[model samples]
Target: MTQVATTDRALPFDVEAVRADFPVLDQQIHGKPLVYLDSAASAQRPVAVLDAMDRYYRNNHANVHRGVHTLSQRATDDYEGARQRIAQYINARSACEIIFTRGTTEAINLVANSYARPQLGNTSEIVITQLEHHSNIVPWQLVAAQTGASIRVLPINDRGELEIDQFEGLLNDRTCIVAVNHISNALGTINPVNDIVRIAHQHGVPVLLDGAQAMPHTAVDVQALDCDFFAFSGHKVFGPTGIGVLYGKENLLEQMPPWQGGGEMILSVTFENSTYAGLPHKFEAGTPAIAEAVGLGAAIDYIVALDIERIAAYEQQLLDYATERLATIDGIRFIGTAREKASVVSFTLEGIHPHDIGTIVDSEGVAIRTGHHCAMPVMDFFGVPATARASLAFYNNRDDIDRLVDALHKTKQVFG
Candidate 1:
């Protein structure tokens, strides 16, 4: 991997200019410059995103798709405009296929409840991987319990890469769905989702990719991947919290029953029977997060203004530099070493609990995630309770990695 030079023109976007756009990054923690490296959990929003939401609430805040007033019309346009932008961001076929939800967790649960529950039978099996977050795991379990279906898990190796052969073996006639993460939140292992989708589709099974971690770092084309469903959180992509997207193939989405019933999701409500709405509106219940959706559009615009390839290249360099630095530290054991990985590093120190390590790092103004990260199965596979994770983004630079390494050394010295 090539190291990014401090004077590289490849990064057309100025780091200082970008940093200035994020107000939160200017703060001090423990009397030192804050080093935030948990983008996988949530990304810091730019001024554009914050301004978009503020602008919406200030001027165009109104209920969508209902009122005939001008404010309602503007709000509806902005809200639907955000959907269109998201559709283009992920290269989905149509805006009708995109349904906004709370986040990735709710998106998966929507699929499990609406599609999997209706289609899967008593003997049907839902195959997922150990790399999945609990959001991806528990929903299928609930669906299985309700439908008399079973849940099968694909295992991983010590390096935290998925066992592809085992995954292939598990795809049989009885498999109804395959729910996997595009990138592991805990390990940063970028799974071969295209292959997983192809294999599952061969058995006439649909695949749902949890793309929370993958969307921020790479470009995703739902059409090219040909997965039945893809889901991600807006907060994970430099957008607002409490807003996410669920993208399904048009046919698949049309076939799935509406998961929730309320005002916007309904066409006609009688005392006896109620008729549901169509496509995206069918899945979106009650009043949607209008301002947040508008802010997500602005976030997408901010990302679009930057060259994605350049951003990804810069992030890869950061990952490599961080990995090399961590490797040189004694007693620092990295949990994930997949051939293809992302901008996340999960590790543990020999003599320190992950929480203790996190506390020490906090003292140095370095922020990292320390826990199972909602992927306990991966922890079980690795034979550890939890590992400290430093998930990076394009805005992060080499200086952040230096701070992380220095903090890790201090953690070891204090604990050892």
Candidate 2:
């Protein structure tokens, strides 16, 4: 264990110091120090995030935006303040453009239901890439089925990069919405979202970007990208679960009908016909995740304080080191070797199932995600059922990569 300074000045955002801030990272798993390498799935929360949530629950635990009481005002201020922070973090035009949801899945569902269903009829078509997660793919499929619209998939090359030429070819006047991921969760491929948005706008189609993976490693400016809609989960960015963000252009959100109708989403209610609330409240139905939103706010503050560019550089170094080490292993074969990628490294060992490799790694206190990672189409494209994935974060170091490689060597010996 290392002593971490609470002082504001720290060089390179010390990995050991950051690790110390996360209490869970100090513990031993299976009698060995825990090496968390699955941050792309979910990141470990620091003391600051945990303490913020705890302080909120202990001192101010009340529903937001309904009551005129003091506690309600405080809670509502905190909740809405989180929205403002998210707006600034992603550089959206206004706070009204940001809506809170359970996570990235609900955000996409909101767009699919509110925007796509009514506007897009039988003749319309929705385009997506083959590398999207189930969250991004399934909702569009459901909307297409119900509305009698067609679904089109943009193919990817063997390196797991989207075929940009094919993507351009797929867009046309009939395309209603283009949904794609900013970064592939399974393959770590960072798609050219700016180009994607520009191409869709040229065809008069709205684009929705799933930033669940990209938000953690890169700075996302929705306004700069000129994307109509963007969705991301808080848990992937070191915040609590059951909280996420959905950013949409104000005019677009205003035009779309409410997806889920409940208490807060309405303006005036009558049995005959009820009026809906304005921009964001129209989309956020029921009581929102109050404390979780506060935790997410704290998480954003933590990341912003550290500066994203430095964190990205450090994580890339770890990625390069891990890639070199893994390439030296005789039976290891890397998957998704895209030129522009995030910190995720997915690979397979000859004559071994991904599940078996994951089990062996876990025995040595190395946590790596395995299986299709909720992207079955990506797996099918790579001609494998699944691959072992070791996703890196800023706090991880070369020693973590060493642990994974050593565990993999032990796995080969055991199976041989």
What's each prediction's TM-score? Answer: 0.96, 0.97
Runs off by more than 4 Å, candidate 2: 1-10
Pick out the ten consecutive residues of candidate 1 with the lowest summed lDDT: 1-10
lDDT of each: 0.90, 0.91
Tens digits of per-residue lDDT, candidate 2, 249-287, equal 999999998999998999999989999999789988899
User: Pick by TM-score: which candidate is best?
Assistant: 2
Judge candidate 2 at residue 274 and give its lDDT.
95
Q: Which pairs, if any, clash in model 2? A: none
